[model samples]
Target: MKVLLVTQYFSPENFKSNDIAFELAKRGYDIDVLTGIPNYPEGKYYKGFGLFRKRVEKINGVRVYRSFQFSRGQNKQWRLALNYLSFAFFASIWALFLSLFKHYDCVIVHAPSPIIQALPGILVKKIQRIPLYLWVLDLWPEAMQSGGGIQNKRILTTIENIVKFIYTNSTNILISSEEFRIPILKKGNYNEKIEYFPNWSEDLLFMRQDFDIPALPKGFIIMLAGNLGKSQDLDAVLKAAMEMKNSNNIKWVLIGDGSKKSWIDDAIVKKDLQDNVFTLGRFPFEYMPTFFKSADALLITLSGEYPDLKLVVPARLQSYMAAGRPVLAMIDGAGADLIHKANCGYSVKSGDYISLARIIRDKVFSDLETFEKLGLNGRKYFEKHFQKNKCINHLCKIIDSK
Candidate 1:
């Protein structure tokens, strides 16, 4: 079958869409990816990728059609909005043009942020009379309000309408979190249209990748990897580190880069957490296990303001599980439920740095045996539920079903 997979981010951008396209290709399906030039959390074009450059190519057996998108410079709110709209506008142009010659059986949209990327798939579906599967990793206006700190009801309502339109046009709605189902149904024409589909861990995560270790502290490291963004509540995470700054044994490390990098840098100096905290910027996804190897515990955080955010499970959690590391979460709802279900590690309520610091001191610090046990439990849970092939096979089954 010929599939047009659409996303604002793809392979070189370090998104799971790359995996989906490649896996489908491996299954003998012809996959074409419609995506923007690779600029993401860093908000700059990746090396060798730029506007009107590398617009057509093959990557991992999938033909890629890159759009001329505005790079999200430093991801300021206005710039982010432009970045999202540019992809929708340019990619829809591609959709309309490609429809004349590319006879795709269906369209699949991988939505991380700016689910607006699905605009092209909707256009393609309408033009080709084919189904559009919207795999939503983040819920829309809710995420914006909670993560972006957008409180203007007018703005949120507009975004909500856009989300509804996207969801309404999607033939199948696949969610990364079960908690997302109810909220999405209220806006979309969803009646058995939504399916609870979770993200899978990368195969490389299960196998250790050999690499030189970065300058991580030689102590009990509590590491947080992935986007350093507002939604991650890194400020509060740093506050927790401050609460335990005198502990001397536990260290806090942040991996990955985003708009929040400067904020985190300022906070580190202001909070006097220089010795207790370290920030190692972005690296390839394959190097995760190597970074994780030095981590005594993996940390994941979510801000508490938006109830919608509670529905999120932070995709990095699956990689942490696959690495067999004990997780330290400052979150609530489905994400916390998953941690509890797997018996992975202890969690404090979102925004509760006091309890989080207490847990780090009382539970997660220097207890090698307990860490090993919790890590083992998490690894076993990942093997059972999130193996790459198993999750993708289920997705294919869903796609092939009536």
Candidate 2:
């Protein structure tokens, strides 16, 4: 089967779409990607890519069609909006032109952000009368509101309308978390079309690795890897570190980069947490498994201020589980429930630094055997639910259906 995968980010930039496309290709599917220039977490364009450059290239046997889009410069709201809209406009035009000559069995839109990315997929589906599958990784206006991106009621309503249109036009919707279903259903009359499709860890890069990285600290490491952003409520983490200053055996390691890194850096110095907390800037995706293996526990957090955040199951959760480490989550709703259900570790309400510190000091640091058992449970849960092959096979079934 030939499938057109649409996303704003692709290979060499680190996104789930890369793994999904490759896995499908290995399964004997002809996959073509429609994406923008590779500029993600870092707002600038990647080296060798520019405003007008190679529009098409084959990466690892998958044909990728690149479109013109602005960079998300340093969290500037206007730049980010332009980046999102430009990709929608250019990708739709590019896909429309391509549709006149080539044919695809279906178009799968991987929506991690800027739900507007679905615009081109909708256009292709309308023009070619092929199935349009939307895989929603993040909820709209809610995420924006939580991030303090959009405050004006008019803008929020407009975005809501766009979201409704995208959901209404899609042939099927795949939600990453079970909690996303009801919220999406509230946006459009596609309840029957929506299916729960949780994301799997990037098994190729996120498995147990034997290599030793010298930078990893010796003490009980509580590591938080992935985008370090305001939404993560890292302020609470810093507060927890402050409260646990006496607990010298435990150390906190934060990996990855985002808009909030500067704030975290300042907090580390101001709060005098240099010894208890360590910040290892972003590393390549291949190095993640080694970092995970080196850590005793993985931390996942989301801001309590955003109620919608409760519905989110951060992508790193699966990676942590796949690495066979106990999870320590300061998140609520679906994310917390998943950890509890898996019996993988402990979870506290978002921003509850007191409880977070207590858990680490009492349960995690004191009981090594229980911590190991929790890690084992997480690995078992990952195998049963979040394995890449199983999830991809389920995705194939969905694509082949109807």
Candidate 3:
């Protein structure tokens, strides 16, 4: 079978979209990925990527097509708007041209945010009339309000209308979280078209890499890996760390960089959390497993108390489990439930720093063997449910049946 994968971000940007494309190609399916320039997580363009440079390449049997897009600069709201709008416009034109030459069985879109990324696939579905499967990783206007803090109802309503249109057009809607179903239904009046399809750990995280890193301190390492953005709720985690500052042997290691890095740096100095909290900065995606292996437990947190916001799932949850470590979640809804259901580790309500601090000081400090057991449970759960091969097979089944 042949597939046309549409996404705003792709390889070199370090998203699961890369895995979906390359792995499918390796499994004997023809795949072509249409994406914008590699600029994500960080607002600027990656080192070697430019408008005309590396526009088309075939990587590991998968053909990739790049479209012109404005690089997100400094992450101002306006810059983000340009980044989304530019790709939606340019990639659609690229798709139209590509369709005249090549043919595919269907189009599958890996949509993270700005669901507008799927417009190219929608265009193809309209023209050639092929199946358009939308893998919805992030809920729209609601997420904008919760994560981006855009309170203007007018702006949200406009985005809401777009979300409905995208949902209405897709041949099938695949949601990353079960909690997202109701919102999709309300937005597009979706019926039998929507299905639950959660994310898995990046395939590389399960591989054993011989990379070495500087030694962590002589203490228990509780780590958080991924974007240090506002939605991560790191500020509350910092406050929780303050309560446990006296525990010299327990260190909070944060691994990743984002919009909140500078703010976190300032807070570390101001709050005198230098001893307990350590930011190791950003590293390559290949090194994630090594860093995760160094941690005694992996921490994942989300910022909001809103019901819909709590339902949002972060992709790192599977990566942490793939590292074969105990999970610590400072979140509610789907994420917190996953932790409890898997019996992987402890969880506290979102925004409850006091409870979070207590859980850290009490549970982590009590019995080390318990964590080992919990870690084993998590790894077992990951292999059963969220392992790459297993999830990829599940993904193919969904696409084939559709």
Candidate 1, residues 39-103, lDDT tens digits: the string is 77677898887765798999878999998889888757898889889989989999999998889
TM-score of 2: 0.97
For 137-225, candidate 2 gives per-residue lDDT tens digits of 99998888987557899998999999999999988899999999888988877888899999998663344466555577678789999
Query: RMSD to native for every prediction?
Result: 1.6, 1.5, 1.5
Query: Which residue segments of model 2 deviate by more than 4 Å?
Result: 204-214
Candidate with better lDDT, 1 vs 3 = 1
Model 1 TM-score is 0.96
The model with the greatest lDDT is 2
Identify the runs in model 1 with alpha carbons over 4 angstroms from their true place: 204-206, 365-367
Candidate 1: clashing pairs of residues: none
Stretches > 4 Å off in candidate 3: 203-206
Candidate 2 Cα deviation (angstroms), residue 16: 1.0
Sorted by lDDT, highest first, which candidate order results? 2, 1, 3
